[model samples]
Target chain A: MSETAQRRGRGRRPAGEVREGVLRAAADLLLSEGIKAVTFDRVASAAGSSKMTLYKWWPSAGALAAEAYFAHSEHQLEFPDTGDIRADLTAQLRSFVRLLTHEGERTREGTGSVLAGLIGVAQTDPELSAAFSEHYSAPRRALAVAAFEKARDRGQLRAGIDLGILVDQLWGACYNRLLIPDAPLTEDYAVALVNNALDGAAAR
Target chain B: MSETAQRRGRGRRPAGEVREGVLRAAADLLLSEGIKAVTFDRVASAAGSSKMTLYKWWPSAGALAAEAYFAHSEHQLEFPDTGDIRADLTAQLRSFVRLLTHEGERTREGTGSVLAGLIGVAQTDPELSAAFSEHYSAPRRALAVAAFEKARDRGQLRAGIDLGILVDQLWGACYNRLLIPDAPLTEDYAVALVNNALDGAAAR
Candidate 1:
């Protein structure tokens, strides 16, 4: 029945609209119900489209979930270049923590859970892991790395510094807290992290 | 039938033997077949015990899995006080990365997958999350924190540095890499991370 509808005007929605609708539905389902609930059929029905449309775009539910999460995060997280690397990074971290922990109209409270579910699925699914790292993690890391590079060129960063590890130090702490659930990702914590990373922890 | 067997001398094994056997069986099942196969009955049968014995120890499969993973990790990870904080931390990170990514006799390649599965389960299961944090995470963090505090007292670490944040920066980077499959936790990378965190990322 859905296949016949797919053949007939692709469920009466334009291609771009259908794609957007499907991704939106996928994101909603994933954030609310988790990765397991974002099946093609459920997304298609939620988006008021057909399963054929979802399958045409996403080869599997993992692909759909990856795209959905990427789309959601891309809109929420922006790497700002405000000249002051410290402020820029602290703002970015705060925004990220907000996105992860906040319960708002568009963002759900279970973002960490959704991410954890995806990580679990990605462990077994190489294709999904690649798609997630490429689409979600790489872009974000690239932005931060670029900012650090700019800081280096501006003589703001230490010489011979490995930007990759620096980025890891800044972001890894938050990820650790998120995974452990022991420490809350507060604004103060973000400030302290940026300060501690920028100022050597060794005795002067 | 299993209940009858449980009443009859607790499945014929001593209490400690039964507990150890069940945990060993649970760990094997978790590492071999993933989290879903670590049911109480499955673990009991695999350990040559009965379901009643399994229930007498762990309340749920998540509890059993947590205990199993913890038991496996406790034997592998130890925070050694080698006096030199730098070498100690770098060595610890190397060992941890190995445990996370290496394939060995007791440790398998699927350690990350097992952890990822636990993280996913912990998201929805508060009881499991608490158990995992209290039993696995808190103790480890405390050990690291105590080491850092000792370093501070010895004037090896900078004054006014928050050891908690310091510890977070060190371990968080590794956790982030473990969660994100883009980067491998190389030993050199671990050393660089420790140095960068200690020396600060800003221009010296």
Candidate 2:
């Protein structure tokens, strides 16, 4: 076997398997050490892949980090259809806050820090910026929107309500706290967000 | 007088004057060139001050950038209490959206970009992080909170409302769009955010 082939698992593993390994390694780095730790060299070494392979798959480090974050968060961030919008929203947001903060026995440690770093770097990197929205935010937001639509159909929500604003209020508030961090991003805060947003702040 | 004194205009400029000039120069670089261009070398040359002076005033590049952003935006981001909560919020949000987007005859080209860059860098920079919240976010948030309290006093808002969520819902949505950018952060969107948060989405 060629040295290159031997280096890349002696041509034994499938390309898809290799890619998954790469993503797993990258996610581990992101969750453990934050975004700055997901370098080409580190990810390549961790995944037993070459820098060339990483470059071929992702346009930039930020892009790779973005995908890694989505991969790591995909299952954990799903909205449950419990037929109660308030309960489901409250549960989902609590889970999200834990994921961003001090979740136990999961992708803890630097998850929020990693996310903040990815967001920070995305401002300047076009490929990373697009990857973040396409891979993560858009899909995640669509899930919330679908859940809200179901609730609306079931008469849990008011008619003529903009579902997008619902997204901006609840989830966007978390993002604000994550980015700016002037207030505590606790589960209680999440529950308060859901309740207040649904109940309205106007005096009846 | 020594050559060094002559170079700095023979110490003709006061320390306060030098600091103000440095801030102006840093803000200009941030607005026009984004965060990367506001290095000590670049800022010192632009402000006609020494790198030592910049370091004496600010701990890091991110720190300087944070203060510069606050200095530039102080006048533009104030909340006006026009006696009507909805109108006041809508106007404030519209103005904010314009500031982040394409307003003419102002800091038009890259205000949002600079803010995004600052927020991004602050994630990894302790000095920048503190400076961002201390100089920009905390003070700015205080302005909004005061206005909301006035409206609450006037019985325009429901009692026992979470004011932080109000800030998050309106401005946080703006920040979310700026960061994740799945949808438009337009004036219409801003108005909708304000109206919906006040009116809410309950079927009752």
Candidate 3:
């Protein structure tokens, strides 16, 4: 599984387009089939590429699925910065919840399963874990941290707060629900999580 | 994989002791050898029980592993109620973090890897997921929620706060760190999570 693949076959389309096509195919397989369904042969065949391209491009099926997942739902999960941390946080989390749970779409469900699949496999797959951090979790986390930093500078958040914990309490909780699933990952839960994190649970 | 086995063997110690021995063997296998190593044959051989006994009792390897994990760590993870919510939570969470990271043990890294392995496999293993919520997470959560309810009753916590979210923010954060590994799951982080959660992150 550690064999490195290089560009070999003559390409009719550009490498960028080929890569995007492969990712789209991979994401579709992941969403429709499941995490275990995404294999190099399947993705390569579905994307009209060779196994060499896939091996050369992605380290593992988990890594490819992570990048595919990110490519599929990037714009839908972006954070907003309106100088109001609470409102911005709520909006982003709401959108995120909607995407994860398929809150409003006609489709049966959304990327929640896909994301959960990647995360589950990432536990044992080092390449997938690194790619999950590099492609999905790290960048998403940085966006939220940036918002927290901005809010802190604007006097909305408390000074010298641990922004990393904020991410864990908020997004990590959502991930927990996705995996554990004893509780629903809903818009209301997302909103409450933000409110609860900002306003302490203890009595004032 | 779903064969049922009844108590067929002749005189052994007792069903109770036999079951406990099996659980201990399974837990030891999990901690030492990782999740993939806990196959039915291996556990049966390790515990000196027949594979028929295992298949009859547990739904899957995942289920058996879940039970084993819970049996091993149950006493260590008990939540305390000393009438002081902050101190109690800090103490319990510190113990939990220690066990997970082997923070205070000469025994290499503790149950953190085991628990993370369980969670990761649970994502795909339905039997594991159900048993996870049933024997492990559900009971564990009930203990914490009961503590929260008592505190809420005593005017220590805000009235009508979502105890589930509290679990998510605190323990869920720990689980998130274990899975994601972006941050170290240290006792200090646990303390900060509990404090940040209780006191809220907003500036007054």
Candidate 4:
């Protein structure tokens, strides 16, 4: 029998339940006390699980933190798809900005800080960096890419436009403002960004 | 007498020399050993200065690190003022990308890692964040903004373009790629990014 099955046969909690509890504990520690506090010992104790379980599942603190962070933020990546490309994109970007700036109601407070913490740790942790890109960044990027491609196919985007670069322009601006915190990510800023890219910034 | 004169009268090295030495040591530690090794004591000893001197001038490790990092990178921010906006902007961005990716001859290897380390720490260190934005980000952003404004006055940019947003798009795209590391930042990417921004992405 698998370790999970053996644990279940021994009348301990199911493997999935234990994983969920551990993740929840990790998330709670991350959100409440920052990334530094979410150590294996603390998480295991908080989740009522063994350190062996966490180690078996996640190889490092960063890996565990990445998974917890992803679970906390997975729902924020839902991009809207209205028929009008401009309006659709504007709304999508506005929502993204709201989330990044912690202005959205659905997102928990301090999400940005938690994310920034993960980003910092991920810089040195190769496994965490790859996991963050795969689980957190790729899906959201795909949503925007899909939207741009759809607009292109429907004859909305100008001919010869590189959709990848276009998406980069749109999202990159938001991420810049978000990361720097020098400027506010207001709704107007979002609208202006989308319009600027769509309607070229050059003088006629 | 000023503080520098008093310190000199007391047989201590001049304030300027002390500050420079400390910064040099901090930069050396940051570049050679990474952020973790740049503690105040380490920097002071490395510079042959005292911890009291480092503490007197910079309030925190992050602040000292920011100043040191900025000093090392200040020359890299000199954007050109060639009349051709596209070419000028492309050259500037290409150089910026090369530095961020640690591909430039002038930029040391592992520069990206140092930068990423600073960014990670800055997320939680408000003093470092402020100092970085003030000493590092603001000046470079101002350079880009000035270029765009000059281009607009010369009829290079299309009318009704928001210069702030345009600059953000240009720099932000590079930053996003830098932070994510999912995409390679090539010279062609720089050229294409500038071209896309200058020319509208909409179907003409």
- In the range A4-79, model 1's lDDT, one tens digit per residue, is 5777644365688778888888998987788889888899889888788677777688878998888875345478
In model 2, the fraction of reference contacts reproduced equals 0.86
User: What lDDT does each candidate get?
Assistant: 0.78, 0.85, 0.85, 0.79
Candidate 3, A155-193: lDDT as tens digits:
888887788999999999999899998878899999999
Model 3 steric clash pairs: A200-B200, B5-B56
* CAPRI band for model 3: medium
Off by over 4 Å in 4: A1-11, A103-110, B1-11, B103-110
In order, the B-chain TM-scores come to: 0.85, 0.89, 0.86, 0.87
lDDT of 3 by residue, B74-138 (tens): 33547888999999999998888888887223225677777888888898899999999998888
TM-score of candidate 1 versus the correct structure, residues matched by position = 0.87
Per residue, candidate 4 scores C-alpha lDDT tens digits across A1-204 of 999899778869978889998888887788777778889999999998999989999988778988987786544677777778999989888776666666333346635667777777776678778888988877777777788888888999976766778767988788777677766667899999988898878776
Candidate 1: tens digits of C-alpha lDDT, residues B1-204? 676577775436567877888888998888888777888889978988889877777668888898888886534558878788888898998787766777755556736667877765675566678888988778888889899999888888987877888778887788778778667777788888889888899986
- For the predicted complex of model 1, DockQ is 0.65
TM-score of 2: 0.92
Superior by lDDT: candidate 2 or candidate 4: 2
Off by over 4 Å in 3: A1-17, A74-77, A103-107, B1-18, B48-50, B103-107
Model 1, position A34: C-alpha lDDT score: 84
**Candidate 2, B1-204: lDDT as tens digits:** 777688676556878889899999998888777888989999999998899988888899889989987887533667878799999999999888887887434356536777888998888888999999998888888889888889999999888888878989889989999888898888899889988899887677
lDDT at position A2, candidate 4: 100
Best by DockQ: 2
